[model samples]
Target: MNRSHLGVLIRMVTWPKKVVFGAFLASVLTAILGILVPWVTKSMIDSFTSHIDVTKVFLLVGLFLINVILSGIAHYMISYLGEYTIYRLREKMWAHILRLPIDYFDNNSTGQTVSRLTDDVSTLNNFVSKKVPEFISQALLVVGSIVFLFVLDWKLTLALLVMAPILTVIIVPIGRRLYTVAGETQNEMAAFVGKLSNVLAEMRLVKSYSGEKKEYTRVMESGDSLFRLNLAVAKLQSIFSPLISGTIMLMVLVLLGYGGLRMADGSLTTGAFVAIIFYIIQAITPISSVASFFTEYKATSGATKRLYEIYSLSEEKVDELDEYTNIFDGQIRFHNVSFSYNKNSKVLQDISFTAQPNQITAIVGPSGAGKTTLFHLIERMYTFDNGSISCDQLQIDQIPLSNWRKMIGYVMQDSAIMNGTIRENILYGVDDADEESMVHYTKLANAHHFISSLPEGYDTVVGERGIKLSGGQKQRIAIARAFIMNPKILLLDEATANLDSESERFVQTALVNLMKNRTTLVIAHRLSTIRNADQIVFLDAGKVTGMGRHDELMNTHRKYADFVEGQNLKMAQ
Candidate 1:
């Protein structure tokens, strides 16, 4: 287990001192009350040797009544403390995961990460709410019982003490192995969850391909792994009960037999022997708990390690040059820019270009030419390996990530709409947007008429990834979303590539409205749409091969001229 993560988890907790103190007080009082009972029973039984004092009998009944009352309060108070602690810990864990870099999500599946939050956290919560307070009182009870037994008959206490080492020898190795198995279980459970989520989320594709049986078999592989681990745990647990129970029975038999002989010889009083028996019964309950607690603690420690690892991850850092955050003339310049996901797979080379403020600058390239990647760099979704991308002469990386992203509105060719109402989708990021503004923007994007046609109108829920809406409707909804931002920069990545001609015309009109007075960067496959662009950048094999107006690129760059000629296109602008 990563001990450092344990420290980090502790610091993450938001402790409410009053509740903690109350819970602790209750637990201690309960343990003390528990200890007093056997002691009181001893007094009552010993009194039998004489007159059997009525007052002592009454005292035992009163103690039982008070114990019952305190037990109720203790259970509730301790549970409340545990629940509240887990709540705050989960809140911290959630916020941390959200703040982590996008790459974390890219590497980890939704199921895997969700497992960390839901399953692993629940394990830790079990330890906190149920195990910890239980262990505390159980430990106290066990210790108090042993002390009383020693005073009654030191020889019997020695026999019990001899059993301790033997039990330790039995339990320690089992605990270590259980810890290992438990950790394996957490990992297998995470993988199973990830696989299941992946299959369900894309069930349409599975049905389309007729791969239902194959997917099920794969999911079952993970399920089988989990089952095997569970079986291993059960086998280990099965060993525990019999070993501990046998040891306990052996102790009881010794007390009865040896203690009987001593009483017969008049060396031991009947009342003292009876009291010793009561103490043994009382002690056995907590002793069994102690053994199980070690087993449980080791198992829970596996989950603790997982919790620690998640919280230990480094979050995304943003350098907030506040002065430059909102300031933009939207002149984007790329100088000696180079980037790659890794060393071998270079996506963008030493690229340089500038998109002027309030002008539609188009980047035209074939597939795999890194056009979409350039847009990601400008949005600061990733850091460029070399060179600089800047807006109005200020390097983008120097600006805060949120602030930089806020300045631009990106509408992809296949823009995703979250599962929500049309109104919520349109105004997703704009918190303060009113209904009037949302409606106005929807009208500008040519989205309002269709939205109003629906029975629920703006209140209608767009199914997962906007499945309820057509390609054109989802596109226009995205446009309206961009309009709400009123951004200085707009990125349109083949925004009409997937739409029909009729849908394109409606979306084009909305795009025209959205593009007005914004610094626009467009990545397009068809050269004709961007023929009137203020500047045309031709990217080929991850390098800019052409830069200038369409007419000029046709005259100077061979590839650009060949592309235009290949399309049998007329030269414009």
Candidate 2:
């Protein structure tokens, strides 16, 4: 194993140091007691063969019972320590994952992340709960048994020592092969999970396109690949177990033959011969257990590596600042700002605009004119490459991300809603919002009437992504969510694009009410919606083509005129 893998194991084991140490001590005591059992049995047999004393027999039986009780208690502690270790590891990992940067989600699939948290963590859990404790107890037993055997008959111990190298030669190579196969199997499982997540998330799209057969074939192919990888692992394990057992049996046979000859010649006592044979049998168990530990360790190592990759990712930086005491004036300016998702292509270039307090600034452009990209930059979801974006003359990058986001409200085209009660979804991030304020905001967004008409009123549950509600109702709920925040700045990204005329009128009215005194930047596709905007900024190919009131742009800018004309023509059609 690499140093990194070893480091992970050491760190995990040491996390609950006191508990782990206690468990270790218990395992050692358990192994010692286990070794004593055979010795006690051998003594009992020898004593019974000679003069039988009731007192001595009772004493021996009492000691045996004590050993059994102590071993059971130690075993329980070992299991407890193992479970606690995994609990701590999983909690730490989950907290770290939740704080990762948003871009991390963009790069990784949901299924893969879920697999790491569920499947990979389970592998680590199994190692801690089963493999670690088993390995420790078995290791101590093997060493103690060897020492006892040497004391009983050094000559028989020498015969057993001869087979050790042969066992190592067989077990080590098989372990390495199992490790490689196990890693492959884990990777294939992750891929299958990713594919499954994609299919389930887009089930509606698949069915709408009548692609059920295609999706079935794709899922089956992924499953088949995973199955084949697991089969390879199974084959290796099948070979590994029997080979170790065969070697162990060979050593037993050789010992039995030699020890029988010694007994016949009066060179070894019968009790001594029986004790040595029992020790060898005891030793065989731990040897097999150690081999199994190697198999589990290699499998868990692969899982640990995957987990480490996620744990090592850089989180979104939040700078420490004195309390943000400055009240936002709702003035936002982008001066010579540029940004790109990739190095080769620019998404926005030299973008400059301003939205003054208590006014509506409409951003109008073609499909790929970087309108939404500008919103993302303003929200600090993605940082700019050049120039400055400031709110109230303070550079945005200087503000703590959490504080900045808290001061602004964003409503997207899709109206994102969680599966929960209406009140819960509205008061999601606003923990301090009272019932009065929630009702007031919902009323303003024109969502209160429909919500009130529901059987449960505000307590009614919105199905997944608010699928139970109408498109307009969902959008209005989103507006209500933003309204309850009472933010100084509001970002509306084509909020009315997907609604019908009647729904648009209702949502637009609610939006106008919500925008009463906020700095609103609306990414508008429908020209009519922005006719009264204080200023309209026209953009094309990542550059600002024009900026003015609607009437001014209609005569002064040809591109703006053409865009207006195209929208009007589409409406007529």
Candidate 3:
């Protein structure tokens, strides 16, 4: 997009060291063969004027054949090497993307990220694999032609040199402008792609809301903006080829006039004049190719910027462990912890609590009272700003995230089922889980009976996000998944919320058994759900207003008492 950005691209190409070197060598060979053929052509032309020697003409023809064959081989190798290098680069870039932190994906759009991985990578691929080699070959040809022309006669070479300064005044500025436009176009295109992805992912929601016309208009507007930006870039690039060819053609005309006078004065030979003219025509190709090279470079510079932007995202921290084991003793603690999703507004403040070994701790509050946020912190989704959290006396921050997460089993209100068979979903967390244990947890979750009714049983496909199953069915399957993991600590976020009364009753019975001899934290809206909890913590506006057993809180705590009464009345109705 700018000078520094162009410099960055040049540096990017050089990263695949072997490919760049091979390209350089191939380009040199190709240019040499190209220049050699022109000399042979001149020799063959000159032979007709004199002795009419068959042997000399045949030798020139043979040399020309060798040049063509060698050029083909060099071209093939250069292109092959460049493509190979780019393939490896694409793989490496993908690997880098996969290693990035979860927060990065949370911030970026799936469409924009996918576009960068696909379109941006493709642009860079073209630049490195094809254009880079061609640019180098053309550059060599231009330089060699100029040197040879000077050796033939200095006056003609001086005439060509006069036009070189024009590049600074015209081509440089145009290239700069093209790069700027191309960069803007790429950004706009990515944004449009992002919008498209958003719409596609939420197409059901869009249709349900009856916003099709409004959404279509917004998409069309984005497309129009992209088209306009691309048109501007194309227009700038279109001006270059004709201008380059015209300048070269003008130089050719001037050379023919000036050289004729020189030949008449007997200062230049007829053979040299013809050769110089041929060189001028040949010069156009290399000069124009060099211009195309810069143009392509500018576009790819934009792509490289986008690619590097993804590569530069910070990755999650990883720690080396020589030996490690899950040592959670079914206990958890929170001491003076404070948290906020944003700096200005705290979602949790100065909260203190503990879940004893083999006990159930339920959290209940009004909506937006930070109930869900507490479970997130306990799971170490985000570290607290003040105080500490410990799992069986181990500070969470000291242990690796992977190890810490493995010790806890979580079942949320919305069932997250990946696209896979029932068996795979049930054992997603464990490696090579035993079938005996699998059947055990499925029965415990009240899912085995329903799954057996399916034609495929445990092998039935869940489809995307478990769309194949009903709400209550999906929830049971999720519970079964978490149940099979056999985690030391269990976190349930309204686990039975999706079920009908019958399903909820069944799931509640399963949960009561599952909570036995484990540290259980439950976030509940229904008083019936948390009525039997060993300890109930009542939250309101980021503050813990009450803490006790459900009956104790209902009797003594005003907020908990109101919540239970309201829920009971709703259930009664």
Candidate 4:
């Protein structure tokens, strides 16, 4: 991650920073207190040989107990604070995710996003709560012990220093390799998670097509990849531990022999020999701990990079207009509008049409006729490349998208719903809808009867994406949602495509009523639905080939007449 990204995360998380800093500060103080215990033992040993001070020995023991108590308390608080910080950070990160643009979600996999939010965040939490405090403790202990060792006997400390350069050299290469492997493993894990999400989301489709074995194999492959990467990291650590232990053992052996000779020569005090052994043991802890700290530091940094990628997503543009004042007289104009999702192939080319105010305009053509693309452009879901889409003689690009969207009620081919009560889903777009207005729209959408018959009536939980409801029921609920929006313009892309004849007739009637006062635009494959439209525009290869009402188009346009004739014959059969 770049410094600016880390700085952004730090800024987002700095609200409870004082608690984190205090916890680290207390942990360092606790490590400092721990060093005093060995010094006290050395003092008690010397006093016993001379004056045999029992009271001083008892005082030293009590001091050691006090240090242990304080250290435990500080460690607990530090850990507690770190965990709490992570909790708050996850919530903050999730909120940031929600505000990000739709394109970000489109470009990324669901599994990868989930992995970053859950696994990567958890890894970062471990770094903050446990590793950070331990790092601080190790630093204080290492520095304090070194200073004391120099005071006791500078020559033995010098001897210990000889191994330091070699350890640093060993750690540098291994630490870098460990980080690289850890990052690869984490990325593999995320990819696995994403694949699982995709399979699970379409579990019904998989089962219907008997794809269980294929899915299982895919998941297993991902697991094997994760296992291999993890094994590589473990192999590095396997070597790392023994190398550090061997170096520490070598230093201890040398210190024991040299110190024994010093004691015999009377160059070092007997009490001081005890202290040096204790200091050497204490020093080993910080050395091993500091090594692990750097190792984890590299791993945590990898997690940080994953998290930063999410935080770095560009936020959606929200209009800064103070008043909801963008006027729309319900006329939509597409003037020489051209668009392509990618630069190579064009989806729509010079698409121009006008849906007059309070008119039911229909767009019809074969599959891939750029029917939906035209709707997307009108909705501003995707901006055009070469021309202007205007409303009431004002350019759409000049208006805030927030206000522009508020003027239209959109219903897609898929009846999109969420896990919520029936009433909640109905009132989703317009939260301030009164009960009478709610009932009126629901009745108009033909959803009121089925909803009232449910066990919980309007309060019935819809389950995830309305899975608890029948497909037809979900479509009615969606229609009611669009109805309640009270928008000046209504945009429907195959709203009745997925419904049975009875449900279709009911929804079509409700939709017809809903479109009465609004400027309605419909994209339909079946010619029957648009036969009564005020204007019908036939699109083929991203351009309008025919334009007129049902009778006029059938008489004048060959494509429109053939499409109507084809579907009419299918109905007869």
Model 2: lowest-lDDT 10 consecutive positions: 1-10
Summarize candidate 4's per-residue lDDT along 1-573 as a digit string, tens digits: 453443455456645666667766777777777677778778878877768878767877887787778778778877877687788789889988877866677788989999988988888788778887677777777888888999999999999889998798889888888777777877888999999999998999999999999999999899999989888888888988999989999999989999999999999887889988888888876788788888887776665677888877776666654375756577888888888887788888888889998788898887788988888777776667898888888887677877777778888888789899999998886758899999999888888989999999999999888889998788788888888988888888877777788777888788777777688998866666676688988998888888988789878998878877876723621
TM-score winner between 3 and 4, please give it: 4
Model 1 clash pairs are none
> Which parts of model 3 have CA positions greater than 4 angstroms off?
1-22, 52-73, 80-86, 319-322, 434-436, 456-459, 512-517, 568-573
C-alpha RMSD by candidate, in order: 2.7, 2.6, 3.2, 2.8
Tens-place lDDT per residue, model 3, 479-512, is 9989887778899998888877877777778887
lDDT of 2 by residue, 163-260 (tens): 88887787778777766776677777777899899988888899899989998998888799888878887888888889888988889898999999
My TM-score estimates for the predictions, one after another, are: 0.93, 0.93, 0.89, 0.91
Error of 2 at 169 (Å): 2.2
Off by over 4 Å in 1: 1-7, 318-324, 561-573
lDDT of each: 0.82, 0.81, 0.78, 0.81
Residue-by-residue lDDT tens digits, candidate 1, 1-573: 553454467567777888778767776777677767777877777777667889888888888888878777877887887788789899998988888876678778999988888888888788778877677767766777788889989997887677788779778988988888988999999999999999988989999999999999999999999999999999998998889888888888888888898899988877678777777876877777788878877887775777777777897775543664575588899998988976687889999999998788999876788998899889877778899998888887777887887788988989989999998899987878888989888887778889999999999999999999998889889988988888899998767666667667776787777777789998866655677588999988899988988879878889988777675545421
lDDT, candidate 3, at 378: 80
Against the true structure, candidate 1 reaches a TM-score of 0.93
Clashing pairs in 2: none
